[model samples]
Target: MPTTPLLSKYPEFGRARVYLFGLTAGCVTGVDFVASSMIGIAGAHIQGGVNAAPEEYLWAITVYAAAAVVANLVLGRIGTRITFRRYVLLSLLVFCTGALLCASANNISELVLARAVQGLGGGGLFAAARIIAQLVSEPNERLPIFVGFGLGSFTLTALAPWVSAELALSLGWRAIFLVQALVTVPLFAMVLTLFPRRREAPTTAQMGTLGWPAALAFGFGALLLLHGIEDFRLARIGLSGGETLALIVGAGLLAFALHWLHRHPDPWLDLRRLGSRRYLVGLGFYSLYYLISGGWNYLMPQFLQGGLGFNFQTTGMVLSLAGVVGLVGVMAHTFNFRRVFRRRRVIVIGFAVFAVAAALMSISAMPGASIAVLMPPMMLQSLTTALIMVQVASMTYLDFEPEDFVHAYQLKNIMREIATALGTGMTSQWLQTDRAIARNDLVGRINTFDLQTLAPELPRTSEVLARLSLQIDQQATLIACDHLFITLAGICIAAAGVVLYQRALA
Candidate 1:
């Protein structure tokens, strides 16, 4: 690759450079939010349009997540090897292509494949944005940019449902992808103009140590594990034969991958680094945070739309309040709170807030619950999520050497994707099982004799029975949601204990 002379020059945080950098960060993060938030709304359209089964819609997310996890690691390294500017531009082009494909997709399988491509590109955007931030700004100057990035991302995430719903209502779900494809054009132009191209060629040794084999193995292992979890969840109670076999194979592949990492001189991931107790503890806290937050993100939309009988527009409006509050929270932390509070203390406080919010959410899952009942928990959870994310990212990298920062970044991104998938999978499994139990219990109370006794008023008609059945299902779902929220509260409390224990040991 020809090197641009501009590549070696660092910006001195000029107004124009800062504005462009912020725009780039916002654009990158916005892509992620748009993709993630679309899943809750677009899944229905994809299912109906493609005639897909309920379980099959999950592939739209799972395949994307798996692809993104692998791409995040691989592309992060590739960017270093090739040059961040070229790699990001290529990724943007690929993302646009994927979005176009998604817009044109006529079936579920095509959509899933397109999403995988999109995820690959999306992962690069995420990795490259951070790399650019590191390259252009001094350490002290980077914090505000990151704060802005978080606000942009969270705002998009909160508003995505509404944007998507309106697009789908007015034009169609395909419009969402079309819009994504169109928006990337200006972003592509900005990257070409603003981002500096690489000047130096990567060393032969650097190129040789790319670890393609380990990367492939790890990616496959992760995909299999995630697929197995999805399979287990869809099976309702116990793992099906296929799910069991898939899990076993996935575990075996992961073990093999670990062994390869241990033995390889230049492994893709530095498994040896796990020996650091601080790193391990940091990962534990990070995973726990994602487990709770991911589950909340996945389940809340359904709870609002299904349990509370809110339409997509109403649900989006209600959820958008969290984003508003979260932006405020991020600003507060960035400007004032972070200066006063230590990272560990901030994290612990965030976890406590999350636990309380989760408990409140559990209590708010009743039949006649109003949007007012949901607001406090939603606001608190969003605020705490912002607090935790910023602190965790800071704390996790505090001990990492410069050379190890890439590895740590890759590890964190991979774990984040995996944790999110697991969170959604576990919540789905719990909801299914709990709903079944609740439904059975509810049904058990109503017998033929009870129906006969109520026939005078209820008429025992099929319409009445159908309505009764729908109510039962809704009630069961609400109870199941409550149970999931309470479980998350417990998890948050346990995570707090983990944080405190690690602090004590330190």
Candidate 2:
């Protein structure tokens, strides 16, 4: 809340240009994160706008997310080739262009293409900002920047969703882009004026042209794998022949990309620099964290609205209130107890909280649960996200030296995109599959003759039958939701164990 903490340690508090720059970069990153979350949460509204099928809406989200992941390849290697000034200006151009196109899209195809272009631009901004911060600041001087950046970024990341939801639902899906515009435009202007135009001599350490082959394989391979998983049917064999082929091809390409990166002296993504069990463990947790968060981000609405029969207005209010609660709790944790627990302990505690929240949801997420009963888990989940997020970002790189920052940073960003996209997709796929199973299972228990004897419905009309079917659908869906939450609880508990296993942190 106070600006004083950021400037207190800086000698040049009179100017504080670096502090401002770091804060701006943090805002840019926040905007990007907000955009990613919005795609998942707002997919239904956006789908209606473009008349896209559920899968097509998913494809639209994936194209943007996939392109964002692809941006990592260039971000890691193109550091010296691209000037900071040029990168900022060019990226903002593409980013804003994509936003405009998204706002005006007439169909799903046009929207996906625009999102891809925008993702490439939005994706680079994060890695690029972190790179510049590392390049410009000394280790001793970096804490304030990190703190300020984290607070500013995570603050926006927490609240912007509520804000975006208000705008998109009240105005239209197009109104969501206004959030991007507000952040990116100011960032662009700041860079244009504040950043020095003089091009410094490039450093020669491990610089090279963009590795197109490696980038394509790594990014596209990931996209393919995600597509196969997201689109695969869950009945019977769980996948058709084409889906099976997609899964195999995608896995092969990813394996090949990893092999190539290991062998190549100057890989595009430089994942080899980060070859350690600790780092890998951290990456796995990071992916899982985002997946859980994103999956819930997609699922909570279904549980509340579709299952419990809440109106849209009530659901939105509860969600927005939950966001506010999360934001406040995040502030408290960030300020008062940020150092009270070690990163590993904090992570364990956070996931434990996640387990608690998910368990609560599972038990209480019944057909007629009250908003008051549902509100606690929603708020607690939000708190878990902020608490865990603060830990993972720093813990992942705590062991790496300064030189390895770029590679590690880019990889983590890549994981964030991939994880969130896959989280939403996989959760959606599971919901449908589980709902169908739940329907079949519920139907098996229902005796038509017993129902007829019990109620006789006062009539044998088509309307009565349809209403009975609808009730069954709602009850079945709620059963599926209960299963989903229990599974999430199990994952949270297991993740707590994984955090405890990291001896490096211990």
> Which candidate number would show the highest TM-score if scored against the true structure?
1
Q: How many residue pairs clash in each candidate?
A: 0, 0
Candidate 2 off by > 4 Å: 1-19, 178-183, 194-199, 333-338, 443-469
Q: Which digits, one per residue and each the tens of the lDDT, describe model 2 over residues 319-414?
A: 767877766765566455436556788889889999999899999867779988888888888887666875666566767887688788888889
- Global lDDT of each candidate: 0.73, 0.76
Clash-forming residue pairs, model 2? none
Best candidate per lDDT, number?
2
Clashing pairs in 1: none
Candidates in order, TM-scores: namely 0.90, 0.88
Q: What is the lDDT, from 0 to 100, of the residue 140 in candidate 2?
A: 56
